[model samples]
Target: MGRKLWLTTSAAVLLWTGAAQAQDAATAQTDQQDEATTLGEVVVTAERRTSNLQETAVAATVLSGESLDDRGVFSLEQLQFVAPSTTVQNYGQGNFFNVRGIGKSEATTAIGVGVTTYRDGVPVFPGYFQTEPYYDIGGVELLRGPQGTFAGTNATGGAVFITSRNPDFTGVNGYVMGQAGNYDNLKFQGAINLPISDTFAARFAFNSEQRSSFHDITGPYSGAPGDIDMNSVRASFLWMPTDALRVLLKVDYNSLDFGGYPADPALATNDPFEITANGPHSGKDETARVSLNVSYVLDNGITLRSITGYQDGISVFSTDLDGTSALNNTFYDRVEEEVWSQEFNIVSPDNQRLTWLVGAFWQQDKVTFPVTTFPEGAYHVGFPEGVLDYYIFGETPKETKAVFGQISYDISDRLQIQLGARWSESTSRNENVYTTYPAFGLTLLQNDEVTAEKTTGKLSLNYKVDDNNFLYGFVATGFKMGGLNAPNFYVPASSFGPEDVVDYEIGWKSTMFGGRVRTQVGAYYMTYEGFQVIVGDPAVPLFSSIVNVADETVLMGLEASAQARINDWTVDVGAALSKSELGEFYAADPRIARSGTCNAETGPASPNCLNLDGNTQGYAPEFTFNIGVQYDVHLPNGATLSPRMDYAHIAESWTSIFNNEALGDRLEARNLVNLLLSYKTDNWTLAGYVHNATDQTYIAAINAGLRYAGPPRQFGVNLTRTF
Candidate 1:
């Protein structure tokens, strides 16, 4: 009923406004309704080639740098609210990012994520370091559904593409911005671009932000959780020896201290903003990444490109498992990861009748724990806990390689056919051991390797109804590799297979009222086999392991978005409605370790094991919608004043398949509102904004078997100037 009402309201508003505008346009127009102002066309670069968004058949959300600033989006965590069918959940130790109801679900390295994220055409590290702020960005593209052909492995649900600004051979230029707000929040941002020669240029950008903790800890904690302090910078150099050859190099560094991730037990009834923790807080994450892009154009209009990337990141985090001020009730996790990757691509000219692209990718990832060489006092992670409990030691390394290609043929002027495929192989090895204090004992757990290979592809047919309307449909397949799990907590160590998915999607795009309005509507049905979920004691993830279900899961959804630009006002609306159901599966609640397993003859071992045959996927709400309206008021002095309002609604969703209300297993629906007012001149602009204007308290994520509260209301003012 809620979904129906939301869609009905959206349709009614569009119809009424469109009709009224049409009547006004008819009185002074040609054969078609004409308007003085029209929406600008957006060009998407996620497809390995640049193309107008309105002409592309893929389901995507594109945001420009200015758009992100106008919408008050400073980090990746806030992106979920603006994009349909997207969810970004932040936990104490890590995060879960899902699109179309599939993504990370456990704290383990034995499996792969369903969604893949890329930066500057290179697939970067996932799961950690996601809180890094966005600065000097060119644009971002969120592609929904399987993107296996383009992204290769680890893409079952969707993909994210982020591109930062590149240096040009233009003259020296840059900008600076500073902000101050409530909660002692302060931010500084700036950039500088310089031209070294006629063929070489460089650009540097930096961001630094600090804010007070939202939590009031009553326990003797050694750190401040729920606080924010981070700094990030980037440098890029572009070299163009000739018109046919170009090379770009980018170096990025980040130093982030989130204070810590404050969380309370899922069953806790205390104020969400208050916490009691006895453990030491550790939230220090740092990373360094470099990418090189080189491209050359041939006389035949073919382009050859090679991209090389390297990244190293270390994350240290601590949490209170009990969410209370209990003695010796702390958990600490510290790790480091290094990755090296290379990709090569060949592309035909975009204007050709037969456009095609072929690419190859290779990457090696090494993740390790700081244990063996260092002693108890050095790391402190599992110090007293190591004596009481035990900690896992060693490393998990993986190597992946893939070859992918896509081709599109023009069947006629109004119709086209597209086909794409990818063959991927991943190999992973676990050389880990379980150990207690040296005084206690040590045991070798698992020293093994696993390999998985898959071939995924897609087929699409697009038809142009006219210059103003288009239709498209496609079928695609996606895959995610699997690995081995070390035995722990009385749970046996086992290997899990890869997850697979087949997606069928159809869409329509149209422009009406002489480009004054644009709309995109789409529907998708997907069936993915072997849904993965963590099964074990939730209190102690050391005992938890990612496992696969026996049957295939089904998901079906509808997505729609509309944008309009009148003489002085711009309006945008996006909505998504999806129904997801898990296949036949059953797992005894991890919280209740004493419960027996379920079986057909025995009926049920425990209430939690009763059947998950038709349960909804966790964190996947049935309906989501967002709307934004901004009016630009012109002044006689050649300046502008703009006022904007943005609102979003996310329906209630379950934290787990069990859906036990008594345990607070469900997240309540939330309504978010934001407002911004801006005053702009030729060379300078000032803005004041407020987010979460309602000041509602809600949980944004569930980790460490506890709930993490979302941010509260915040108001701020910022000023920017151009040189």
Candidate 2:
């Protein structure tokens, strides 16, 4: 069935591409270029060069401003259709990003995922911040496969980069948008650009959104509620102090507060679930970021650039495992994190065939989490005699430093080769300070520290079939440093080592029928070593932690996509297939001797037996595909109507690396459809969209026998005015 669907989709795309080419040829002879022009040309800096999407050698996808606005894609979660191998899942209050079925899962302390996220050319401090807001975004770039040598650390799976609208010095331009939807959802956004002078400019933007939940809980309580409120503002200044130098400074602040329904388990019987009538679980997050970029064009075709940034954020979240459970049964987690980074790079101009970039980066991150678990009716239920209470508090601090360099030489006009390398080192420290009432006799203080170093590299060869066609092959390596686990009541913490993977890929990029049709195809194989897997014992509580269990895994995949323009209509389609297998996964487990009874008052004494085998990696989906179509209609009144449709299919996947039967289940395939309608005049545009139009029932993420359901059908209308 999958193969048949793949063939049908491919045939349809090829037919459309052919039709677009024929139309382009006929129009080339004449000087008439009257098309709706809803799809604008996308410009990207994926390779640090201002080039069209079809001109880049790297396997990348670009989402233009028009597409973003028309689809009402205000967050990274809404960009699933922008690429073939990309999927975003939310676990707990956090987000997990997967590319080609490879990504890290959410945890208090673990670093196995192989992807990195960046905003406006600067890497976000930690990998846990993938859920950052996407307001006032100009475009998004998805670079597939390992990009360690080019994008720095954590690029084993891929890299997602977002660029925001910058200050414009040429003219005064701005836009305002307002939206209202079901569930009493409201949103407002606006941006303004000021041309202070020929050498100075300023831009400011702000957005606010609020919405209510769609699910109703009727278990034990009536009027259970869910709500989300978010606000963000950014201000930027551009100063051209000299003709050869330009500086940009930006400051952004965001705050998100939400209260929502908890994860409700599927009942054995078809009984309606109701809440216990307690307060809803809630999460609050606040972040502030400041960045400065300086670029200097020196003599002899050399340019120097520097990016410096700092981020500070704090989050408080509470989860009620069972909605009918009282508030005392809830779990509370509070986290605070601060990060700082600086990078400097020098690049040679494109005057010669040999172009290169060399840079150095330094970053530091500190995160502290305080977790507390309470029994049911801790506040109301009378404390039983001899009962005990406990709290867990820990802090993790990581520091990273690296120096990287890349150089590309054109062996000939038709063939070019590039090589790059990076040497990086990281250190992590975990400290846990706890207190237990009734003198539980457990250790109250513990500390662990781990450090690792690695050198990653990339090599690529590009062969141009012609100006409109090219083939490329590359090999790259990526690494994620390991860290220590916080001490828990049941066991002492352990340190882990770095995990690494090498990816090999061959791809082709072609602009077939003139410049109106573009297509890209690629195949890749990856091998991993020392893969990190999280393991826990269901028999014993508080045994969940990360361990380097398996030594190897092999992943192979193929991807293809195309975009074309036929008359006033545009179409885009894509598909991906992959298979992954683990080798020698049974060697990591060992039975340990127990020193004391399981219910001993002093807890398991001395050393406890640790079993760490047979764990499947998390968030690796075997098959996924996305297909889209868009068209534009020009009316007699000079107004244009554009509509777009997108369909996505995701195959079964595992949610955790440790393949425990209790935690492992095949997530059935899901079909999601989205539609958008928009009208545009000379200077104004109005749009409406429906997401998950099919109202499918699906799970966004699952772990440890728990699943987080995906959002239901949602429809909204947006109004925009530009001046």
Candidate 3:
């Protein structure tokens, strides 16, 4: 099936090329007039300095505002399909992200993150909060590989940077959109810019959407609509005090309410869009953030910037864990987090022989997490009917401080060498307490404090072959500070050390055929130490623990992407191939340990261990790729028509670290295709789209012994007006 799909896609590309060539010859003059409208130059700030993406040495992907709208991407979940080397998996509680085969999938509250997500230059808390919706944005940049020099914290994998549209002081402008789709979906969005004075401007944007559930529930308890309700707003104020100075203040808020997991108990016998869960199930998430940014140009042609940000968020959910009508198991979990951060940076003038940037960052994060479980009915099978509720409460406070600097030296005019380093210190204090209801007495209490410090750096050399081509090579190191684990039953370990990785890469970027075709190809190798993984505790079958597997792991991959403007058609193609090797390691789970050498109490085993030597990393597909094409047709009335198609495929991969076949941990490869058709006038746009046009049946995620199916085929229409 995979081979056939690839062949079909290739044939389509050939057909499109032939058609485009024929049209180009007939409209040669017209084509020349449109030649100036190729893919625009992509500018990125991955290294704390603004530079053309093709000129940067780092491996990264940039999605412009137009691309985001064309793909109908509003969340990180949709972004996974747009980038071949990145994967975002939902684990019930929230989404887990991975880039280049390095990341964690568990939804733990107090653990450190591998990939850091930032909004407008400010880092956000823990991984789950990274799921916020994307709207009124300028661009989304995904920096692959390690980004430790400037990112400073929890950047072993990479980073995602989101840029919001800024307020315009020249005039007033805005747009409004209304959308209706299948499944009783309705959405509205609007944004407006107001010029308050000669030097100050304000912009406000908002979105409200609601959709009925796609799953049909059939169980003992009342069924649910599985609806999706979300509202978000953002306000920005920009002040230009002088020609060399500017200040910006922005505040954003979002609220989301949804039916619980759209999942089935077992993948083997359940329908793709049917669930048989019982009891009340739902979830809500609220978030608010305020940020201030000031930038001033020095007399020496340098720039100094300062950013201050504060965020407060809370997420609460209740679900039927067992996914059955029987009241056997249910749970309620809540996470409240607060973060405050400040950063200062000094950037040297661009195009200079010696370009440098220095920065200092400080952040404080506090989180309160708690979970309660209820047991009832014959769900326990022979247990007493009157079972007490169990509760777990935890509080984690963390602080981080760092200083980093990077310098790039131009050797002659064709070769440049860049070097950077960062020193970071972090402290974590955590407390966990467990108790059972009815008695309201504590069963256990645990506390731990940990402090860690690390120094990381980057070195790169880039060579410009010509105006349209460049070759680069670089080596970078990334780090993630580790901390204590929640004190649950039979957990003997209290703390873990930081996880780190070193990455090496070489790549080429080029634009050929007179700017008609642009391509980027790269190869990378990464060596990881102290890989963090979540697994069932050896001493307790039901409890989970996060531990750093004591072994050296290696990952290597190849990435290629191309964009072409052939006549009236635009084509984008990307492919990624990667492999991971987890070194031989002992299993902490006693149940998986070998015979008599395992210790029963601590389960630390005396030489007896279960080796997972040759397993692939969880959710890391060996091969993934995407292809998209869109064509523009001019109408006699001076309007324009566009039709587009996109296809993405994910190769087979394991969802479980252990690759446990007995538990059905393997997921099969799947393919999806989307279609879009739109008509545009000078001030209005009307569009319709079909997502998952083939109604592909695939497992989107597997966690806590359940499988979640991807959304089925659905179609929608949107109308927009610009003022």
Candidate 4:
């Protein structure tokens, strides 16, 4: 019902305002627009070649730098509110990002991720490395559905591509921005570009942000748990020795110090801005990455490109698992990860009847993780109420290699066909050991090797109805590699199989009323096999493992978005509706599978090994939509004053596959509003924004058998200058 209402309302608004429009009176200014003419064409490299977004068959959302700033999106998690069929959730330790009801939700480091994230064309490892402040970015592209042909492994759900500004050889230019707001929030960001000769240039960017904690800790440990202190820097260089050859180098570094876990007491109170922890709680993250890209254009209109990238990062976090003032449970986790990759590509010119690209990619990744737990006697009586410190030290080294090729042929002036395929193989080895602090012979060791391979591809056909209307249909396949679980969890079920998906999609794109209005609608249906599920052990609450269901799962969804320029007001609206159901499968509910009672005839009697058929996937909301309007008011002082308001709604979603409301894993629906007012001139600008204007409280994650709340209402002010 809610989804229907949102769709109806959005359609009505667009239809009513579609006919009334003036060229320059109230213009919808976007980053890709020229302002002098109609809306400029948006170009994207999602297919390894620059192409008009309206002509691309892939379902993607492109958020330019200007759009991000106007929306005041500072973190990756906040992006979900603006994009359809996306969700980003965080608990005390890590973040989980999902698109179209597909993602991983667990506290393990051995398994691969379902969704892959790339920064400047380099894949970002999971955990802390994936969460970073968004500053000085060129644009962000969120691709939905199967993207295996272009994104390589671990892209079953989709991929996120973030591009940073590159060094330019066109004179000196830069910008600086400063922000201050409630809760003692402060931020500073700046960039400088310098041309060191006609062929060489360098650009440097930096960001520093500090914010006070919104949660007040009151317990044995009395300190704020939500404070943030982070700094990041990037340096890029461009060298063009000749017209045919170009070289680019980029280096990035980030450091973060979170005062404590950003979680409040769950099930104890309704307040989302208070925490009670008795154990030491803090988190630190550090990363350094470097990449070199070289491109050479041949005289035959063929281009050769090579990308070399290396990254290393570390994360240390401690949290109180009990979410109470009593020191009953605490745990600490540390992770060190490093990755190296090299890719080579050959591309033909785009002007010919046949455009093609061939690429080869190779990547190596290694990681180590350690954990310690402290549980008081109140929870369990298996042992004395003493600190049971355990460590998980493992070196999971993996090598992945892939060869992919894509070709697009224009059969006629109004019809085109594209076909792509990728063959990928991966080999991994896990040398792991689990040991206790006392060394009382409580140790576990494992040496495992695994190899997997898959062939994925996409086929699409596009038809142009006219110069301003287009239709497309495609079928794509995606796969994610499987891995072994830690021995500390369970030995019998130590490994899980790979997961795969097949997606069928159809979409339409249109630019109506002389480019004053742009709209897109896409519908997708996906079939999943060997769906990997991560869950906690019923007998041992602290242990987690992954399982692959025997039956197949199905998911279907529709997404629509529209942008309009109506005289003095610019309006943007988007909506998504999705329905997912699991096939018949047997699973144990952690909340009910207690007492440790099990037998062949009475399997897991306490919880009762039950069928999870027809259950919805975790965190897959059925309805989501957002609407925003910006009105520009011309001033007599030759400046502009703009006021914008944005609203987003998310329907209730399950946090666990069990789908039992009695366990409190289902989060209720929430509605949020944000407002921004800005005064702009030629050289400088000032802005004030209020986030979560309604001050709604909602659950963001259900981790460690407890719920974590999202942020509350907050306001901020920003000033930016350009030179």
Candidate 5:
């Protein structure tokens, strides 16, 4: 099946490349045709400074707001189909975005996520808050590989920048959209723009959606699961006090309720989506954020900017743990997180040989678990006698300060050199008390603090071979701070050290066929040290722990992407090939250590250990590719007709560090296809779409001895009206 799919995709690519056509002078003169070219120039504003994407050294997959809506890519999970080398896996409590075999794969907060996600200009949301949908956005930029100088610490994997639609000083304008789909789904998303005054403009957007349960709960479940109820509202105001000064403020809120992801005993079931577990099942997330951005341009053409952001998020989850209607197997957890951040920047004017940008950042956040009433962020099982860690009440406070800068100097008309660096310091304090089951053992920690400091840097050179071709290469370093774990009864209180990574890459960008075809290709190699991973503790066997494998892990990959436009056809093809190898390391197998070992209260240093020298990283697919095609046709009645198709595939991956297939830890490769048809006029558009047209059933995640199924096939129609 995989081979056939690859061959089909290759043929499609060859069709466009081999048959590249040239348009007549009269046909090329039309603005409509020029705009239809999918390979048009785009300005990447999310970087340290605004620059043409085709001229930059970064490897990014950018999508406009219109393209996102047309492709029905509303969330990170769906985004993987359009962006190569990206992965999103939902683990019930939270989901994470992984890039190039890096990022967060564990469901714990003991260590920070490797990737940085920026909303507007603030890295305010990760984990559960990341599940929020996207709407009324300007664009999304997914930068692959380490972005140390750009994103600072905790960006070993990559960075994602999401910019929402901003209000313009124009007349009142906006668009409304309504959608209906299978599984009794209904959705409404729209936005309004208001020009309050000559100097001020405002934009308001909202989204409300709901869907029926996809799971057939045959067992004694207390609440519905595998359903969606999402609502969000956002308001943005842009104020220009003077021609040289601007101030923008944005406020956003979300109340998302995912009735919970219930799992069946995947080992005994053919249908991973159908479940028979019984317990109160609910997955609710509430988040609110405020961002204020102020900027001013000086007489010398330099710019000064300040960004301040605040966020508050609360998540509640409860579900069946064993997933087999077990007598005493359920989990209840609740967590609240709050963050405040500020950043200031000084950027020199663009189009200069000596361009530079300097910035400083500071952030503080607190994570709390309401133990008396809410059970959150942990798993425990019972056998009619006792359960491990009945009550865990804790507070984790963290703060970070950093200074970063980048400089670019043109050595000649065809060559440029760039250098960047960031100095970061972070502190984490854990104040918590842990209470065990049946025996009622207690572990307490009062204001224990750990500090981590790192200096990361990047160096690159860009050479312009000609007007339509560019070559670039760079080496960069990334860092992620470690933190103390919550104390458990059987294991000693421990803390992991920070992890570091160094990445090397080279790339080429080119345009051909009179700007109709644009292509980018890159290859990267990364070495990781003191890699952090989450696993069951050998001491308690059921409790989770964070550990660092000090060996030097290696990762290497190659990526290629091309966008083309011919006549009325638009096509995009992207593929990534990668290999990852874990360094030599030995540890007790958590699943079996309880039954054998010298010391029952030791970890990694026990007499008997499992050799995990060459295991593959979890969720790191060996290959991924995406192909999209669309064509437009003019109608006789002054309307336009369009049809689009998208295909994507993810190679097989493992779910655990052990990589044991017999233990049900391997995830099979998956192929997804989507179809869309649309009719458009000047003021309105109507479209029909079938997402996941193949309806392939695949394991999306594995945690706590359970597996989750990805979303099933969804067919829907959408109507949009513009004022």
Candidate 6:
């Protein structure tokens, strides 16, 4: 099946490329009267400055605002299909992101997930608050591999950078958009840009959305419609006090409130009625950031830059996972984080020679997780007599300091080499306590601290095949620091170690048919050591422990993507395949020693299992593919018509880290179709769209004892006017 799909996709690409070539010839002749331009070049701030994507020499995916608008994408979760070897999952209320099949599960204070997120070059949100708000974003950049040199720490797998829209100084502009559709849904969004002076400007934006639930609560409980409300406002000012100095100040705020269903228990014999009703969940996130950047142009053709930033945020969620009739029977979790960082770099200005960037970075963050389980009396009914009632309260504080540098020198016109390295030291302090609970035999109740330091490096070589084509190969090493874990039923103490990976990749990027078609292909081999795994500890009663399972993993994969414009229509297709395996394990801890040797063959729940270590790496799909096509037609009445279709497929996957058993393994593949019809004039535009046209029913997430279903079909029409 995989081979056949690949062949079909290849044939489609060839046909589209041939057709695009033919249209390019005609378009060239028409350009004599009016100039025609291709897609706008993408510029990203991944290296602290705006640089063209093609010259960055990194495996990155750039999504433009126009492209996002055309696809009707409004949130970060919808961007999963745009990048290869990437997946997003929802664990309860928090969102988990994975790159190259490496990510964490329910535990937040662990070294498992190696990904990090940044907003406008500032790190605000911590690992506990991964489900961040997405609003007023100008564009998003996804760096596929490690970004240790430029992105500071915690970017072992990769990094995601979001750039919001800044104030415009050109003129006064604003737009309003509204949508109404089935399921009693309504949405409104508006943005305005104002210019105060030639050097100062500001922009403001806001959005609100509400919808009714699709699931029916037929039992005793009553279910209501789910709703989402989000508001964002931002202002930016550019000040120039001297000829060689420029200061830009930006301030933004965002808030999100969502009431939705909770995770459902596992199905019994395929019975759909076992699912629970949509619950009442509410969450709010607010962030404030300030950045100061200064640049100096020296007389000797050298440029020096300094960037400093500070960020603080608070996130809270109040949810009722179990729709019980008892009052205050809910679960609430809140996280507050503050981060500060600074960097200074120097680069030599030259067109065709050596370019270097050296900088030092320091960052510190403090995150507190206070969880309160209401109506604690109900939880102690099953316990022994005289047991005290209590809840979980934990706080984690982390500090990191690092210095990194990168240098790129052209050995010759056809050959170029780049080298980068970073040295980092980090420390974590964990304080956890159970208040109002009995101290006797309470399992885990203590404070834990861990610290680690490491140095990583990367090397890359690129060879130019021609003006429009290049071949590159690279070897990079990345690491994630170890951390302390909160006391729980399964773990008496934190049992984690630093996770590291060495990746080797070779790829080619080419533009063919007079820049009408673009293609990229890559192959990679990755070796990981000290892989983190979640294990149930028998000594700690009911709690589970996060530890570095004594096992190695080898991953090999191939990825290919192509885009072509055939006349007025455009098409994009991509696919990836990977094979991962776990190596032999040696007994290290006493628990494994008591259970015989680590190589023993055992059942899914056995503690001595070793050969199936790969299964414990949750949410890693072996095969994935995405196909999309869009067509646009210009009408005679100065209107336009566009239709788009996108389909994503994933092979059966193991939902749990232990791979004990597969849930929703044979479920139906996701097929989503979207339609848009729009009419545009000089200053006004109107459009209508039908999202999830099929109204397909599928599980968005499935775990050992829980399942989460996706949203139903929705249709809405929107109108926009610019002044």
Best by TM-score: 1
Candidate 1, number of clashes: 0
TM-score of 2: 0.88
Deviation of model 4 at 30, angstroms:
20
- If ranked by TM-score, best first, what sequence of candidates would result? 1, 5, 4, 3, 2, 6
lDDT per residue, candidate 3, 280-306, as tens digits? 566677899999999999999899999
The per-prediction tally of clashing pairs is 0, 13, 2, 1, 5, 4
lDDT of 2 by residue, 298-324 (tens): 978688999998998877655544444
Q: Which model, 3 or 4, shows the larger TM-score?
A: 4
Candidate 6 — worst ten consecutive residues by lDDT sum? 376-385
lDDT of 6 by residue, 67-101 (tens): 66666567655666666667776544456677777
Model 4 off-target regions past 4 Å?
1-37, 222-224, 264-266, 370-389, 435-440, 488-493, 536-544, 594-606
**Which is the winner by lDDT between candidate 4 and candidate 6?**
4
lDDT of 4 by residue, 1-723 (tens): 465746745674565355434433334456355353355577787677888888889888887887888886777778888888888877643677788988666656656777788888787775456667788898988899989899977888888888889888777899999999998999999998999998999999999999988777777863347788999999999999999999999999999877766454445455766666676566777899998989999999899999899999887676676667655566666777899999899999999989999999999888765343332111111121246555555577888999999999999999999999999998878866443434355667778877899999999999998887789999999998888865663443277788899999999887765677777788899999888776544335445567776688999888888777645677878788898999877666654534442222234433555577789988899988888899989898779899999898888888878787766777788788989999999889999999999888887777656677777888989999988
Candidate 2 overall Cα lDDT vs. reference? 0.68
Off by over 4 Å in 3: 1-35, 221-225, 266-268, 370-389, 432-442, 490-493, 538-543, 588-609
In candidate 4, where is summed lDDT lowest over 10 consecutive residues?
A: 376-385
Per-candidate TM-score against the hidden true structure: 0.94, 0.88, 0.91, 0.92, 0.93, 0.87
Residues 1-723 of candidate 5: C-alpha lDDT, one tens digit per residue: 356445544654564455344323323556765665536687687666778888999898988998887777998788888887888887664776789988987777767888788998988655557787899999999999988987878789999899999999879999999999999999999999999999999999999999998788777887679788999999999999799999999999999999988886646565876678766688988999999999999999999999999999988888777787665577777888999999999999987899999999999988887555334455333332145436456777889999999999999999999999999999988776444564554545545789989999899999999887799999999998887866765556788888899999998887666677777778899998888876555456556677787588898877888888877888888888778888877655556544433232233454345657788887788889898999999898789899999999999988777788877778889899899999999999999999889898888777767888888899999999998
lDDT of each: 0.81, 0.68, 0.77, 0.78, 0.81, 0.63
Predicted structure 5, TM vs. truth: 0.93
The runs of at least 3 residues in candidate 5 whose Cα sits more than 4 Å from the true structure, single-residue gaps closed, are 1-38, 374-389, 436-438, 441-443, 536-544, 594-608
Error of 1 at 625 (Å): 0.8
What would the per-residue lDDT of candidate 1 be over residues 234-306, giving only the tens digit for each residue? 9999999999999999999999998888777887888978888777666878899999999999999899999
Candidate 4 clashes: the total is 1
